[model samples]
Target chain A: MAPMSFAGKTIELDADGNLANRGDWSDDLARELAAQDGIAELTPQHWAVINFMRTVFEKDGDAPSIRRLTKESGVDTKMLYALFPKGPAKRAAKIAGLPKPKGCI
Target chain B: MTQTAEPIQKVSIIVSRGSLEGVYPGLIMANGARMEGIEASLFFTFFGLDAIIKKRMNSLKVATVGNPGMHMPTILGAIPGMSAFATSMMKKEIEKLDIPPIGEFITMIHDAGCEIYACKATVDMFHLKKDDFCEEVDGVISVGQFYEKAAGAQIIFT
Candidate 1:
């Protein structure tokens, strides 16, 4: 995947453009990636999903799937799509600088 | 002038198996699509009809006999009650994760705006009436109709 350069930090990305190193992630980096994904601004609802996904990844060793997101992220399914369009689990994970979620098609 | 990339607008999943393990992949994929802000649909055919039939949909069992993932040899997998044992284990694991049961999951998918369809040929072959399906079923449709709806959509078969 192409490298993403922002805020004077160049970060490697996986084939799907997720952060190659989790340590490379920051709120700034997430904002940049979210912009590239066509989300111009991160709302409180967006952070709710990103933070929930990152927390789940830290504890579970993988990002949450759609089912987990709807059931455990305190975000309803419709809002999840509105917050992270075209694939919430994948798009949110990418913007959150996490790996692609398993079973995310 | 440059052409911008177009977003995926829809996904169509063809679920052709009736096993407990077989059905979830399609459901998961469809749900994933809706979660992504895409329209989604599921076309159930053949033995997969069991996944929508009101009487059998909720009672799907994991097929251990021909399943290599079961880890048990086929001979041992055939032991009496093994299928039920595997089904119960799967159900327990799913519950442990707070995932809804089959019936509820189906309803959840429908409530989330995923269209559900039963194959007309399969319904006819099984002598099933419309009421025999879960109310979530949008319609009983022929393959031609399904393809018409699936046009320009990403198609997944599981």
Candidate 2:
């Protein structure tokens, strides 16, 4: 498959469809997302949760199971699901800004 | 020449749902935003808190009633098929269409530096301690604080 692109820029890829800019994080993404209702109000709990989600993606190239996320991050899965609505991996991936996870597709 | 402002301003979404159908839109939109480089956030409140809960996040079912256009697999879902099996099949189809798991998609947004918030009032109302939530959450905030962040940002409720 071809790479993902944004704003007239094609996503740079690695051998494994990995990203070229591993540390491409920018506050703009967060600010833009924060404008949305689901994400507008950030809390400490949410931050740790999303960050852990990113960590999982970075390490596994996939999202974490809720059980694993709770075990690893200590966030309440019940609560997380309530916040995400669409299953945590999918919801979190978008907010966290990694590519759509591989296995998810 | 008059300067043209950037179209497609950033917008954030708040999702508060416990059922499968309710959650899908939020997850889909958040990822969709990241795909388009728009900002997205998903704050869990009240019953919507389920997605953030680790153990229960996987097997969440969408309530059939009160949800229009939520097509269920009637033949398989009802006529002697395991609910788990049916649910997984449906989820797989969605995933095949590139729907990220709530957790994974949330991570992708964060990886791109999007915000995720938990509602403190909702947690308290539900009598949940902070220990009940995931570490990826930025922190807890009241609705007022949330609005402070949401100022000048597009707010969507899903």
Candidate 3:
């Protein structure tokens, strides 16, 4: 397990840099993680996606796939890429304090 | 051996078959690459153009006659409508796994920024014009143009 220090608190992370303990997650920690991923500020639109991811994870016990995020999250695929850049699904999961989604599409 | 490890940044996939099973592996790989922040492009050639052809894209069938994966006797597989039956069965299974249909899958990947192109030679051989393809197709290109676009990127043949 790797440990990351954020906002004077040390947190355990998995090999992929996702938070190891879901219980340790907080809104502040999400902001910190987003910052580390190069997002300067968390906009309302960002929160919409982060919160949607968290809500889905709570029920499904896994992060939603990119397809679900685009179809059900009120954010289209292009907008998702624009918001998260690079990899929206993986990066959004990391910032949302959820495990990496396993589906291919 | 002393070379440093570098992550893949781009992939250009060549799809040469048009069957449902033959086309999906390439589409899945391209979609997966895009999901990982890697740039991906798909080049459709020969029968692979069926995947982008407007009239055929949604109707791709499983090749029941010669496909051993179905474990069916070739004689039985050759029966009328056998390919359509197998294709429908596969579609049901795919739906159970939450996989979108071919048409929707193509649109989704295109929206996700995966580049799609058709081979000009194949288009000409089939007498297909650009309008004969689905809207998602970027354009038809020559092999030379494909090689140029694939420069510095990993090339995958499917």
Best-performing candidate as measured by DockQ: 3
Error of 1 at B21 (Å): 3.5
Candidate 1 per-residue lDDT, tens place, A30-70, comes to 88889888999999889989999899999999988677778
Please rank every candidate by TM-score, starting with the best: 3, 1, 2
TM-score (C-alpha, index-matched) for candidate 2? 0.53
Query: Candidates' lDDT values, in order?
Result: 0.86, 0.64, 0.89
lDDT of 2 by residue, A5-103 (tens): 644556554443434454644445544444442666667776787788788887878766554666688775456655555445555665666655554
What is the alpha-carbon lDDT for the whole of candidate 2? 0.64
Candidate 3 chain A has its poorest 10 consecutive residues by lDDT at A62-71
1 against 3, candidate with superior lDDT: 3
Model 3 earns a TM-score of: 0.95
Candidate 2 residue lDDT tens string, B1-158? 23475644466678788877777777666655544446566777777788777666666775544444546555433544455564676688777665566766566555544677888988888887777766667878889888887776778898
How well does candidate 1 reproduce the true complex, by DockQ? 0.31
Model 2 misses residue B86 by how many Å?
Answer: 4.5
Q: In what order do the candidates fall by DockQ, top score first?
A: 3, 1, 2
lDDT of 1 by residue, B30-100 (tens): 87677667899999999988888889988999998999999999998999999999999999988776567
Q: In candidate 3, which residue ranges exceed 4 Å CA deviation?
A: B1-4
